[model samples]
Target: MGDTFEAVKEVIVEVMKIDGKDLSMETRFIEDLQADSMDQFFLIDGFCEKFDINISDEDARKIKNVKDAVEFIDKAKA
Candidate 1:
């Protein structure tokens, strides 16, 4: 999960253009990071590219926080 978290953090920091130091498992994309709908799409795309996994819109909607992203990727890889 640590590695997945780091990878997810990298994508969020890049897409959201924010400091990685402030990110955590509980960080919310919309509320905490101030990400808009487009930002959320790009974030999901970035994650797909980074992890080489296909995330459907249905699944993407369920990932509301850093922990969710990390856990999703970990499970997808498994």
Candidate 2:
């Protein structure tokens, strides 16, 4: 996996309170990880806080999967 994937996975693991070892680029926040609605919102908030940037609703809406999140944050950091 790329560095970007690793970073985003870190946020997902931290926010969802799941095992880091269990997270992957293919991991689904809801189905695979069993994350609820609150976990979803908290994941977004935690990601923003970790990156020190605000991810707009439209941009966030694109993040349906881990790959999308990595791309989003990679762009934001760039």
Candidate 3:
């Protein structure tokens, strides 16, 4: 889960065009990171590519922050 969190963090940083130093588990994609809809889309795409899992739109909506994403991915992988 730690590795997955780091990987997700990397993907988020890449997609959001933000510095890795600015990231944290509680960082909200929209509120903290200033991510728009397209940024969200790309972030999901990055996650899917990295984890080899498909994230549904409904499921994606529940993932509002880095912690949410890592937890969701951990469950999916399990």
Candidate 4:
């Protein structure tokens, strides 16, 4: 989970162009990071490219926070 969190944090930092020092499992994409719809799209895309996993639209919609993204990626990669 630590590796997954770090990986997800890296993706978020790259895609969002924000500092990752404050990132955490409870951080919210829209609420905390102020990620718009396009940001979310790129985030999902980035995650797919980074983890080599396909995230369906339905599944993508379910990822709202850092924990959600990390957990989803961990599950997909598992």
Candidate 5:
């Protein structure tokens, strides 16, 4: 995996208060992480703050898993 992915994982783990060992690209934020809409908003906000990139509401809604967030940040960073 990429450093971007690791960073994204860190953000998710910190925000969701979950074990890092249990996280993966395929892990769904709502289904697996039990995150609600507010949690999702916080997650997107955290990502933007950490990466210095803004994510639109529509775009944020499309991000469903760790892989999506990592890819989004990677592209935004690029």
Candidate 6:
């Protein structure tokens, strides 16, 4: 995982109140994280702030897994 990926993991666990040991790159936000759209919104906001980047609503909607979110931010920066 990249730095962004690691940061995302920490944020997800902290914000979503999930067990770190239960989370993996493949874990689905809705299915595994049991997060609602509101949670997703907060996550996007927090992620962008933490990473000093911007994430559009459309881009945020495309996120499903941890890896997906990390890749989105990584690609945006690139």
Among the numbered candidates, top lDDT falls to 4
RMSD of 3: 0.7
- Please write out the lDDT profile of model 3 over residues 1-78, one tens digit for every residue: 889989998898788777888788899999998899999999999999999999999999999999999999999999
Q: Quick one: ranking by lDDT, best first?
A: 4, 1, 3, 5, 6, 2
lDDT of 4 at 49: 98
Give the CA lDDT, 0 to 100, for residue 40 in model 5: 97
Whole-model lDDT, model 3: 0.92
Each prediction's TM-score against the native? Answer: 0.98, 0.83, 0.96, 0.98, 0.94, 0.89
Q: After superposition on all CA atoms, how large is the RMSD of candidate 5?
A: 1.0
Q: Between candidates 1 and 5, which one is better according to lDDT?
A: 1
Q: How well is each residue in 1-78 modelled by candidate 6, as lDDT tens digits?
A: 468878888888878987787667798898887899888988888789878899888888889889898888788778
Residue-level lDDT for 41 in candidate 4: 100
Q: Poorest 10 consecutive residues of model 5 by lDDT?
A: 1-10
lDDT of 4 at 3: 89
Which consecutive 10 residues in model 4 have the weakest lDDT in total?
Answer: 69-78
Worst lDDT window (10 residues) for model 1?
13-22
Summing lDDT over every window of 10 consecutive residues in candidate 2, give the lowest-scoring window.
Answer: 22-31
User: Model-by-model lDDT, in order?
Assistant: 0.96, 0.80, 0.92, 0.96, 0.90, 0.84
Lowest lDDT block of 10, candidate 6: 16-25
Residue 47 alpha-carbon offset, candidate 5, angstroms: 0.6
Off by over 4 Å in 4: none
